[model samples]
Target: MTTGRHAGSRAPGSCAQSAPLVLALLLAGCAVGPDYHTPPLSGTEAPQGWHATLPHHGSRMALAHWWEQFHDPVLTQLVEQADATSPTIAQAVGRVREARASVSTNRAALLPQLKGSGSATRQGGFGGSQFAGGAGGLSAGALNPTLGLGTITTLGAQADASWEIDLFGGKRRSLEGADARLTASEADWHDARVSLAAEVANTYLQQRECEALVDIGAATLSSRQETLQLTERKFRAGFVAPADFAQAQATVGDAVNALEGQRAQCAQGIDKLVALTGLDHDALNGLLSKASAQIPAPPDPGVPDVPAQVLSQRPDVSSAERAVAGASADALASYRSKVRQAVQEVEDALVRLDASERRVDAATMADAQYAKVLEASNARYRLGAGSLLQLEDVRRTALQASQSLAAVKLERAQAWVALYKAVGGGWRDDAPNPHPDHKTTAPTAQGRTHTGSAS
Candidate 1:
């Protein structure tokens, strides 16, 4: 009997040990869907080299600090401020947080769940003798503080645990998808920052260009007014015709009109800058006052010889790649289309940037030649060797050339900004791992705060 009793006890222990092993094997079962692999770039997807001209012999530039190349502290500050306060960035951060939470929820589903419960009850009543005796005795017992007979109390507690076996690894696949989405969300956040910084820089550049053009207009107006005064003196002395005097008067009127128009454009540019930087008018004006009105010259952002390297640096491309990885096999084709679009954007920006640089060179040469002609005409006129009409004609040509140069310069700057945005503004896939604590608030421009992921 003793041996049989020991054998029975060991059987229960053996079953208990085997139960955990069985659960672990179930958890390791094959997943239901296909595993993801990155598609290899080939043909049009990857090129040997860029078709567009590479700036600086295809040298690599640190994209993260691309704005610093301008050596403009105000540009850098404005970019930083825009990055901190952009609503688009805030939205991306929210998506990342949601994805992280989903990952946690899915991970927990793979583990055993437990539950505990408890209950208590109490009763009081008269004893058998008191009830059998009569109504009077029962009444007396009810009146008594301690009742006549039985009082009872009961307490109970219980615990339960359950686990839904992942059977075919559905839960694991869900976790995999969640992780991929989290990666995509992070990439999107970086993309937003890159776009916002480029926008702020471009707007600031436009504002400065507007100011420079205003200065040019002022100078041109002053020169035309002096010509008008000279023509008026000549007309009074009967040395010039009424036709000449009328032409001079009209030229001065045109100059005044042009100068006022330039001033209006400069004011409009300021409004755009204010919108982008989230700064009030006074504060924005104060910041603008600190810097001269010259457009900030952007440095060449070197392109990599390998087209694949450049494509990989783009955040939108990275995000698209992650989308492919997260999708079911049936949906992968759609996600790949996004990747192709991203590559196309980079190609387009490269072409524009290369063309803008060449245009700027040509415009610069034209402006210098026009200035020379205007200077010679002024000297001849002052010495009484050239007509006033000839001098005014030269001045008009010079002014047009100057305006063209400024416009081309602005176009070149905008092209650089587009390229910076297309290539992901120097953001890297290997940014430092997100903070472990997951701080939920970040400071914005002007002492304000908003809920967002830490930088």
Candidate 2:
């Protein structure tokens, strides 16, 4: 060893130890640039093929084609057409183009721009006096007089350009920000597709459900009308009291009114579906005639996966995650804004989870209460003490409870989708492009309950 300070200089490991420093300096010496350590990401593990709890997203999401999940041909056609021609999707495409243009504009500054410069001029004196200095004339002192328009225009083709050099990394950081924004815009486009698909699917579901309700109402009304006729005949034969006949008529009238209300709701749902597909009512009716347009209870939707992120292909979830990314990129562009908005978006997302939990709880409670009512009514009927009115009241209560439970479940599932999305879950499944190094699944809020109406 040469000395204490130089002792380690020649050591075998010393070179390796200094390699990191050398590399750091090499990176630093080129320019003081913005080193983008990815913003605090929500996910950690690469999303494992649509798990319930995956964190990082993949290159593409299945939910991007959400309508296909319903397996409706008409819906698929409408979605494809809407995707190609809808103003909303067109707007999103325009945004992508604009962001791409911005990136190009910013990147263009990274390289020297060459320009061919040329100028032409016709020099003339005031009042047509003798011209002295023109592009084709001699200098003022070399001319006979200096009173003419002295246009000493140089017509040389000169290429002039400049770049910031990115020495301080400012330009590079700006470029990074721009690049991120460009990608974010692309994500935004994908998000728009997802939103449209979801809107169509959800609305289709609504219309179908409305159709089912109308069917139920029609059946109930027809049944009550028959009962009323039976009661009137029995009263005419003096087999039942007049009060019973009147009651039957009243029940029939109620059923008729209910059916009319349901019909109106079904028509409104038809209008909503039409709006979603941008089709006229006649066109919608034509489409409806070709299909059942009936919505039954949806299947468990295959549960999507345990953590639910396994189905990271859900469009709503993907949209949420894209929003998170957009907010993240936006934050990078404006640091304080990112932090503030990140919290806000996260809060909003968490709230959805909270709302879902609450709805589930409420539905559970409602189911229990209605269960008690149904049990009581059954017991009274068994004892021959409960009137038909009492039995129907309890039956209606139980039915309403079931419907409420279903609605709550649907909303809860939707909230789960919203939470996963807000936290950037779906994107990590099939990212549709390269993603930052992080796993796919992430949660939005604390696992706890909060309240809201499911609808």
Candidate 3:
């Protein structure tokens, strides 16, 4: 019975010795985590029974050539130059490339970390030769085995690798995190693109709006001069009051100050354009001419049924989402980061929405106020109680008011787009029901459907 027990124990030891190798082979096909499926994209379904976000049947315009949407060749070329020359965009692009490479590296490390190494050395030591007293005479080792018997030079190269196999899904989860970050980079690139395009449009719009202001100011100045003349004549003929003359003089002074202020603003706009372009402001002016480039109104294909993708397609949305993810990852990286910070970021994104709404409200109110003043002044002037000076003031005020409203609307549009961007709201290239803007149609010019570039 003792002999049988010993044999049994020996057999179990033999099996245990082979277990690791068998297990290694068995585990070859497995990876960790529920294999990474890209997070589901939103906006696949039509909203409210009408085609979402695009009621207009327009086709996809290469947002890459977004400036072309304005039908401005000059704008296209200028934008191209800006893309090439702008350090900011270049930096952003570099970051994208870096992120892509890092992800590749992360994925590579997950496979197998292999390394080859070699070393060579030459040394001499006392040898234990069998010449003296039939003993290998090595004085170094004769006293003890501390010294090697002989010196050997070795050259070797080997390929070695080890992997934890991600049995717990830690590394695999890490890879998923990396992939999410990569998509985040792509989203950031898109955000830069959208932002650049919007800025260009804003500048162009501002330049035109400034020109409108200048025109109004000049008209007002002329009317002020006319009023001053008539008032002087009235004082000479003894039919007008001194108060009227003084008011006329004051109005003319105000108009002059206003015109000067506007000229400064127009100059400032030009300066901004200069900074945008690597070229000198004067050179750009020569090219662009202070004469307004006719702007094409944005196509109202229809109100876009905003996708439920409140976070997938919008840059800001994606950015904010990434921030949340990043914060979560950071929190994981170190327990020092409180969960409250992550929660706060989400709250911040929500607050941005409220801020945007408030801007729209403020703009609308300002515009309404200006409109009221403009109309009242014009009405009084037409009734002949108000002087031409007052009429010019009204006209200028009305122009500014209208422009303010347009600017506000532009801001609102931009804010909505930004909110959508911040929320990760957009159709991926592979999305089934793409936005109508993603559709294609022939480009139109200033309403004539001409395909001319801007000058």
Give the best candidate by lDDT.
1
What lDDT tens digits, residue by residue, belong to model 2 across residues 1-455?
A: 35965866668587888998788667657664334343443332222223232222222234334445446677667666555556786786677567656656766777876765655554434434444444443343222255543343323345566654555555555555555555555555655655565566556666665665666566556655765666677679886678877877887788788879877987887887766667888987887766653443221222232223332333333333334333455544454343334344434544554565567788889878987887787567545476546655765676577566656655654543444343333222332322222122221111111111110
Give the worst 10-residue stretch by lDDT in candidate 3: 446-455
1-455, model 1: which lDDT tens digit per residue?
99999999999999999998887787566557667676776656666777777788889857765787889888888887776677787787788788778778977998999998776554557665332332222212232346546645455667899998888878877877776766667666777777788878888888888887888788899988888888889889898899988999999899999889988988887788777778888888888889757787778778777777766766666666666666755546655665566567777878888888888999999999999998898778766688889999999999988888888888888888887777666433333323234432221111111121110
Error of 2 at 125 (Å): 12
The number of residue pairs in model 3 that clash at the backbone is: 36
Backbone clashes under 3 angstroms, per model: 0, 39, 36
Stretches of candidate 3 exceeding 4 Å from the true structure: 1-18, 25-32, 36-66, 73-78, 111-170, 293-296, 301-306, 309-311, 316-455
1-455 per-residue lDDT for model 3 (tens digits): 99999999899899999998788667754644344322232223212222222223323223234345556565655655665567676666666566656556766766977777765544455656432221322222232257645554444456777765655555655655665555455555555655665565567556656766677678767866876787788678886678777877888898899889988998898788777757687777775663463433333212223333222334544444444443364433232122223223323433443454466577668767876886687566545577655666665666566556555555444443333333332233432111122111111110101111110
Off by over 4 Å in 2: 1-30, 40-64, 122-164, 296-455
TM-score of each: 0.81, 0.59, 0.59
> Highest TM-score, which number?
1
lDDT of each: 0.73, 0.52, 0.52
Ranking 1 against 2 by TM-score, winner: 1
State model 2's lDDT: 0.52
